[model samples]
Target: MPNITVQLLAGRDINQRRAFVKDVTDSAVLTLGARRGDVRIVFEEITPDTVANGGVLASEDDSRAEVVSRFVPQASS
Candidate 1:
């Protein structure tokens, strides 16, 4: 059995995530000789504030924050 855990910023659509999971499982099944049922994929979504880069909070870094913010939908005023 293969257990894969992916941690990423919380912004992707449900369909995107599902497709990624399916692709990963299919690759494992073909390349690793693992059964579809034995391949496991887990996704962990976190906010930019919860992640950091180069010892600085992601929210505090303009460049990093911009990248993460792009994935998040803009809120209506």
Candidate 2:
């Protein structure tokens, strides 16, 4: 069995996760010979404020503003 853990900032849509999971799972099956049914994938979402890069918090880093802004929950249609 192959266990995979993905960590990313919160607010990603289901479609993004679905596509990523399928692609990664396919690669795992082909490279690791892991059974599709036996592969386990877990997602650990973190807030921008909880992560840092180059000693600056992601949420507060000016250079990352655009990227972090995507995690903001959008209003419904």
Candidate 3:
């Protein structure tokens, strides 16, 4: 059995996870010779407040604003 762990900031939808799981399962099945039933994938979602990169918190990373906007809830003006 092949177990995989994927971690990312929260807010991605079920459709995104579905596609990701499908592709990863396919790769494991083809490259690792793992059976479809034996491939395990786990997703761990981290909130922006809890994740940081280059000493900058994800919630406050200006350089990542565009990508972060997709996940962060936007308040109506």
Candidate 4:
């Protein structure tokens, strides 16, 4: 049995996760000699507000403006 963990920003839809997990599992089964039924995968979704880079929260980081914007709704001008 093999345990795999993945962490990413929360926002991607379930379809993306499913596709990723399927590919990862297939690769593990083929390359790691792991049984398809015995491979365990875990996903940890983190909110932008909970992460920081360069001492600035991702929710407030200017460098992440474009990436963060994808998960947040913009104000009407």
lDDT assessment of candidate 2: 0.89
The TM-scores of all predictions, comma-separated, are 0.84, 0.89, 0.89, 0.80
Q: What is the C-alpha lDDT of each candidate?
A: 0.86, 0.89, 0.90, 0.87
Q: Which stretches of candidate 4 lie over 4 Å from their true place?
A: 72-77
Tell me which of candidates 1 and 4 scores higher on lDDT. Answer: 4
lDDT of 2 by residue, 19-73 (tens): 9999999999999999999889999998877899999998789998898788755
Model 3 lDDT on a 0 to 1 scale: 0.90
lDDT of 3 at 75: 57
Tell me which of candidates 1 and 2 scores higher on lDDT: 2
lDDT of 2 at 4: 93
Compose the digit string of candidate 1's lDDT tens values, residues 1-77. Answer: 99999998888999999899999999999999999999989988887778888998877788785777777654578
Residues 1-77, model 3: lDDT tens digits: 99999998788999999999999999999999999999999999887778999999987888988887898676588
In candidate 1 the C-alpha lDDT for residue 77 amounts to: 80
Across residues 1-77, which tens digit of lDDT does each residue of candidate 4 receive?
Answer: 99999978877788988999999999999999999999899988877788998899988888998987786555588
Among the numbered candidates, top lDDT falls to: 3
Q: Which whole-number lDDT from 0 to 100 does residue 46 have in model 4?
A: 77
